[model samples]
Target: MSGQQHILEFRFLAEPTDVNFGGKVHGGAVLKWIDQAAYACAVAWSGKYCVTAAMGGIQFVAPILIGDFVQVRCRLVHTGTSSMNLIVDVRARDLKAVRDRLATQCVLTFVALDAPDGKPTPVPKWIPESEEDMALARYAEKVMEVHRRIDQEVSDLRPAGQDH
Candidate 1:
């Protein structure tokens, strides 16, 4: 509907040079596409430059091949004071295929930034409007919780007084 809405879709054909040595589309290319889509969605919602803060749960479900039509769908699932949690799914289908198959999925966090200073700025709050939206929002919360625990564990492992 509107650019400020929760969803953004990016569709394009997989190019010949996008493949890896195995003849399948490279994961790096797919990741780049996913990041681009997420960035677009974040900028649209925040109306400010947004930088990726973190990415998690990256799953490569299937391989993408050259000549397949690729689609990257990014959806805003939750929001913190200055961050937006987005779910990005990449799907691809051959020319004759009727439906696309999931190729990759990940959750990305982007933080809106204030210009000049490049400090984190508050983003517009996101409200779930449907059951699906609510479920996704809850899922994002769980993902963030796991990330927090992992971060804490990593921090605890560091030598005392060595923050770097």
Candidate 2:
């Protein structure tokens, strides 16, 4: 889903070190980029340190080959008392073919933290100033709904006698 008006762009070149012997970039490498991009976006929005609280809906749609240039784009999707939701999309550009394709997508949850004590901190409310921005906000709401249901289902499945 689309998110806030501001989109943060992060780019990296995939080298042999980032790839497996099969020539595809490792999933762990992509995940690290996603988290870095998401954290940067959250900090840009909140102007504070942010820590990852959770992540969801990680889907790998395409493979990134060695020598591909990878780009991660992130945007704030939702906000709560001290947390912000970010959606990040990872794409790979084939320098040889000059083609760009989506490789992976994920939703990340981050909480603003006080620098002094690493306590929970508040972030500014996401204000959509245009029609398109408002539409993204609506999409974020829908994503949040799905996240809530999934969380509830997981909670319900836990053994009654065990601590979750």
Best by lDDT: 1
What is the Cα-based lDDT of residue 30 in candidate 2? 92
The stretch of ten residues in a row with the least summed lDDT in candidate 2 is 1-10
RMSD of candidates 1 onward, in order:
2.0, 3.7
What value of lDDT does candidate 2 attain over all alpha carbons?
0.83
> Per-residue lDDT tens digits of candidate 1, residues 1-164?
22367789999999999999999998999999999999999998888899998888889999999999999999999999999999999999998989989999988999999999999998889888899999998887788778878888999999999894
Task: Estimate TM-scores for all models.
Answer: 0.92, 0.84
Per-residue CA lDDT of model 2 for 1-164, tens digit only, reads 22333469998788898887788998998999999999889888888898998777789999998888888999886778788888888999888776799999988888999899999988888766788766766676676678778988988999897665
| Model 2, position 152: C-alpha lDDT score | 83
Error of 1 at 7 (Å): 1.0
The true-versus-predicted C-alpha distance at residue 72 of model 2, in Å, is: 0.7
Superposed on all Cα atoms, model 2 deviates from the true structure by an RMSD in Å of 3.7
The lDDT of model 1 is 0.91
Candidate 1 at 118: error in angstroms? 0.6
